[model samples]
Target chain A: MIGAAQLLPFSLLGALVGADVVSFPQAMLSRPIVAATLGGALAGNVAAGVLTGAVLEMVAMETLPVGASRYPEWGSASLVGGAIAGWHPVMRPGAINHGVFVGIATAWAGGWSMYALRRLNGVWAERALPAMEAGSRRAVMSLQLRGLTADLFRAAIVTAIALLVWTPINDYALAHWTVGRAAAHSILAAAAAAVAGGAIWRQSHGAAGSKWYLLAGAVLGVVLVIVA
Target chain B: MTASDRAPTTIAPALSWSARIAVFTRMFAVQGSWNYETMLGPGIGFCAEPALRELPGGPDGPAYRDALARETRYFNAHPYLAAVAIGALVRAELEGRPAGQIERFRTAMCGPLGSLGDRLVWAGWLPFCSLVALLAFGLHASPLVIVLLFLGLYNAGHVALRAWGVSTGWRSGLRVAASLGSPLLQRGPQYLARAVLFLAGLALPLAIARVIGRRGLEIPSHDWKIALPLAALFAIVLAALLVRLPARVEGWRAALVVLAVLILISIAR
Candidate 1:
């Protein structure tokens, strides 16, 4: 079991990053790559963090976060990924795979948590209506601060719960999983590639001149890769 | 008198520099208190509070109360783009415009600003930056470098947009909508969209190739093994079907489908 002392910093980090998604300071620090890296850094395993983050980043690419539509919550989820990968430390076969799996699972759960938090916020907003209607400065500030605080705690709780639930599972999977490194990596890379491809296809399929533009970008990327 | 005609008498910049800063800072919390019913309504009113407090009528006055109630009705837009609306609304309030005109202006701006912001930030900019970060990470760049690159590149565009949006809206009020329609905004997302697609195409193949190469998979050069290629072709076809399906394929479903295919491939081998 991960100690509370060890989990505390990551939980806080999750809160800050989660809040960044929609609440405040939307500086993209909440992106899976960044959040996972930070989580890994705190856990003393940067490389594992990078690996987990890169995979999660590909999956996260498809999410648009448009308007009020519910989407995967990447911030706390990446923390879960990075923490698991970091705790394992050893680059055993399927270690990164376990991290990715846990990360995706956490993200799925995080989506539901976000919906619930929104509902909670709705309740608080409802309760604050009279003062807000009266233009009470204290009331307005309190409501905003209260909403932000609620989000912070929600993220923290989600991160803590995900870590508690998944760390042992990841540890067991890493120890017992029979998948070869190359096979696991291949499946992961292909899956990520396919998802990324589908997202690009969805975005560019209808726009005029987008096909040509996509072609040009693809060529440029290939040239860069070949040169490097 | 027209809102603009009576502007000189009533719109004497009641907001101090500090008050403007407060408003701008509050813009960050425009969605802090969001709810489905009002959908940013309360948050918008909350953001406008600092300015509302500073209006000629004190906080308890009818004007301030009216303005606050007017803003809390219903409002929803991209938080970043809503800065423009906030700035314009501030001007409207200060100019003593009718609440109806202000509400109409805000309601009108919501759809366009929201859509434009969604297209530019979400669809265009995010994917492009994410691909760049993915490529950087894939190439084994330091995590710090990758993080800095993603944050720096993304925020540079977004912060500039937010600042420009507010200032432009302040200067032009509702006319700022026309300015947002400029070719630069229109072409920016289009170009970024193309770049994102291109990056995905380039990155996906290369990633698959690297994994295959690392695994020492021999196909064309060694045994003319067609299984991998066939599987890939099948995956592509599946992906195409998912994309074309009338119903939206949730992310998890797509992921499950991909994983299932991989499992089948592994079993077949």
Candidate 2:
């Protein structure tokens, strides 16, 4: 029965992590594994979120947020992981799937929120243009604060809502959702492998003569199986 | 239109260090959504199509200031776009150029910067970090460790790129990309880097698998899976459709196609 109030910490943490991606002292704490683990820890499910975040983080490793390039809204992706892991019932070992769904969905939500926030910042800055031209530092400062504050509030609200609504739903899912272990592992592992292969494909597909990168990744996959 | 105004007397306000940091933060605002062109709504990231407004002042009280207000309007419409536009604005003002001249320079920078930014930063760098994260998944490591590693690789790379972009001009940013060569050759180095890191990423997983061989971590046996191969078939079919389609289709459409294919496969099971 988590409520909107319960989501404040995740929202605040998400904003802080998102902020760190571009501003502040640049602490790496906002990362998926760390942030999600922290989220789980807050909700008394550190182990689940941490485990799921680790997997998702690995799959996400190929994404590099280079200049003006759009990345997966990891701010929310990690938050979802933490939330799911924290709130989902652990008596059943199938909690990871719930976290995955939540993480992926939240990542999408975070991305949209970021765009809205950017638009908001732009409008705020425009309103202060006269004062800005007149050497009014206070005006410019105020506008900047407005943008920052709005973003902080948005993250807090999203976190609160997701936790309050999603937690109980997740419980119902765990209690009812049924799939064989063979099927579950086959699907999850396959999906993860496909994503990994795609990453290798993307990297190798671009090289001039290096078809070997793909071969290497394949060999690595085989090695993983052999060793496992 | 006055000679004095063109004589470099209209000094733009100096941005403080804190302001610069805020501007830097603005980069993240556009990081995962759209490229500069889309965000700016078709022209140069923001400078190309500034929103105009009527000032309350008299006819000749610095009409350029009104234009400045328009520029400000452009910034206020989209902060991230504003940051890109302002970078050029600051450069133009520093050079004592008129609005027309500034617009020209911004126009010149936007196309290449947008294309390169899309490829280098979003397309190339972000995916590489995701691969690193994926390796952690393979290891079944704790989520905390994964997030920390992801934060380390991604934020470090992103912030460093932004710092580089802000400190140096767009030219330097391009030069950095060029240093890696065309997109085709650029990833060769990354693959090599990945191979090295793959070894590192695989270490713990290998050790644990050895200890738990044929136990705890075993996958239950099943019939040869039909789902993934079907997905691959669907992807190939769609990719062929995409390739055969006219190139005039929008870039977002292409992204959507790929996304659709991925989603179909991910959910097919």
What tens-digit string does per-residue lDDT give for candidate 2 at A90-185? 524345556655665666576677666666655655555557555343453455456556766666666666666678777776566555433333
Calculate candidate 1's fnat: 0.49
Per-residue CA lDDT of model 2 for B118-153, tens digit only, reads: 455444555555555546655655555656677677
Off by over 4 Å in 1: A219-228, B1-14, B206-238, B256-269
lDDT of each candidate versus the true structure: 0.73, 0.48
- Candidate 1 C-alpha lDDT tens digits along B150-195: 8899889888888887777777765678888799888887777777
lDDT of 2 at B6: 47
lDDT by residue for model 1 over A10-101, one digit each (tens)?
Answer: 89998998888788777787788888878777778887787778777877887888868998888888878877877755556565666666
Please give the TM-score that candidate 1 achieves against the real structure: 0.89
Off by over 4 Å in 2: A3-6, A18-34, A54-74, A86-91, A109-140, A195-204, B1-92, B140-145, B170-269
